[model samples]
Target chain A: MDMRRLVGRNFARIRREQGLTQEQVEERSGLSQQYLSGLERGQRNPTVVTLFEVAQALGVTPVDLIQPDNVKMPRKS
Target chain B: MDMRRLVGRNFARIRREQGLTQEQVEERSGLSQQYLSGLERGQRNPTVVTLFEVAQALGVTPVDLIQPDNVKMPRKS
Candidate 1:
């Protein structure tokens, strides 16, 4: 599997589902919008800490960011 | 949560459960045993691709390596 693409797709989907913009996520994650954009494009390979920070900012677990499309993660309300 | 430690613990536990050593995992994952040791000690922060490679080498999904302690993953045969 293309893990980077999978992560990017999941991240984009979750962010959109939560009605958040990349700029908003950038502010929350303390990551640059450019970086977020690159990540969404699967152009950035983020470390575990970066992944955790992004997941935290998105109000989700790191697992949620990398889950395969076939597995449905229960959303937090 | 300390994502590094959590990942390390999970990795170590899963590796042990599978009866494999760091050297063996290093051989399979193409990651050095030194690196794997550091990772297992929560001293290394790996990229998502590295995580995927390690998980694949272990014959498990990336989710399995990062699963929270409270979430019991069904073992694959």
Candidate 2:
């Protein structure tokens, strides 16, 4: 279902929006940076709790992660 | 991430709370039953749009899908 792409698309954006690094999210979210990297690359499928953890660490809800945010600044490619 | 188990753990519960079946969710959510089955079984990782579709079909937000519901009815195994 292109789950990786879907999740990856928002992973980094949210991290950045919160001014976080992979390590920071990993530390706060209890998710490994490698896992966060994989999720950012659309290569991982996190569990429900992991989803909640990351969202919570980002100071948002899980819905905030899936739904498009109005912070329209483009990513630095 | 134990994604399959995590996703599967809640997939059916949510569908039941909404009183839907694999087929009904398939049609209404624009997802195939097979895919829905995989999702329910934690064998598939749906895209963001797919996640949105299922959440919309359930008349709940994506947060509703992942967050633990107050509904305490257990599954009939």
Candidate 3:
């Protein structure tokens, strides 16, 4: 395993769909807006716990964040 | 928002109950073993994107990660 981009993009998209701002996410998840912003860009490497916090705020599960859409396994370079 | 531990512990407990190891999670999620290890322990602060990857791997949603359990608002210091 090397990289995971789907998660961040999906997360940001979903958040937008839900009409939630980074500030609200921060207020709900106790995470800073700056960090949340970074997460959306896929620039930050989050821990499982933090993932849980963000997930809880969004009303989903950790599994949802990591599930592959097409189920295509990419080869490591 | 100051602290959010429920998410991390809940995630870890669920993963453990599901019989998953950090290596297995890494293998499934395109994440590193060390990073996965840190995530399980809630030591890592994951970005939203990483959160998505982890949730996807677990077969859940991001909402599941950030949604507060009791719906109780903690007083911010």
Which model scores highest in lDDT? 1
Q: How many pairs of residues in model 2 come into backbone collision? A: 1
Inter-residue clash pairs, candidate 1: none
lDDT of 1 by residue, B46-67 (tens): 8889999999888888888788
Worst 10 residues of 1 chain A by lDDT: A64-73
Which one wins by lDDT: 1 or 3?
A: 1
Off by over 4 Å in 1: A71-77, B72-77
lDDT of 3 by residue, A1-77 (tens): 32245557656877887899989989999989998887788776675566567778887665555554566779899
> Per-residue alpha-carbon lDDT of model 3 for B5-53, expressed as tens digits?
5556656766676688777878889999887776656576665566667
Rank by lDDT (best first):
1, 2, 3
Model 2 Cα lDDT, one tens digit per residue, B1-77: 35445556567887898788889988897888988888887776554455667877877665555554444888899
- Docking quality (DockQ) of candidate 1: 0.80
Task: Name the runs in model 2 displaced over 4 angstroms.
Answer: A68-77, B1-77
Number of the predicted model whose DockQ against the real structure is largest: 1
Tens-digit lDDT string for candidate 1 (A1-77): 88888889988999999999999999999999999998999888888889899999999999999889976669999
How far is each candidate from the true structure, as Cα RMSD in Å? 4.2, 8.2, 11.1
**Model 2 chain B lowest lDDT segment of ten:** B62-71
Best by TM-score: 1
Restricted to chain B, the TM-score per model reads 0.88, 0.74, 0.70
Clash numbers, per candidate: 0, 1, 44
True contacts kept of each: 0.94, 0.15, 0.30
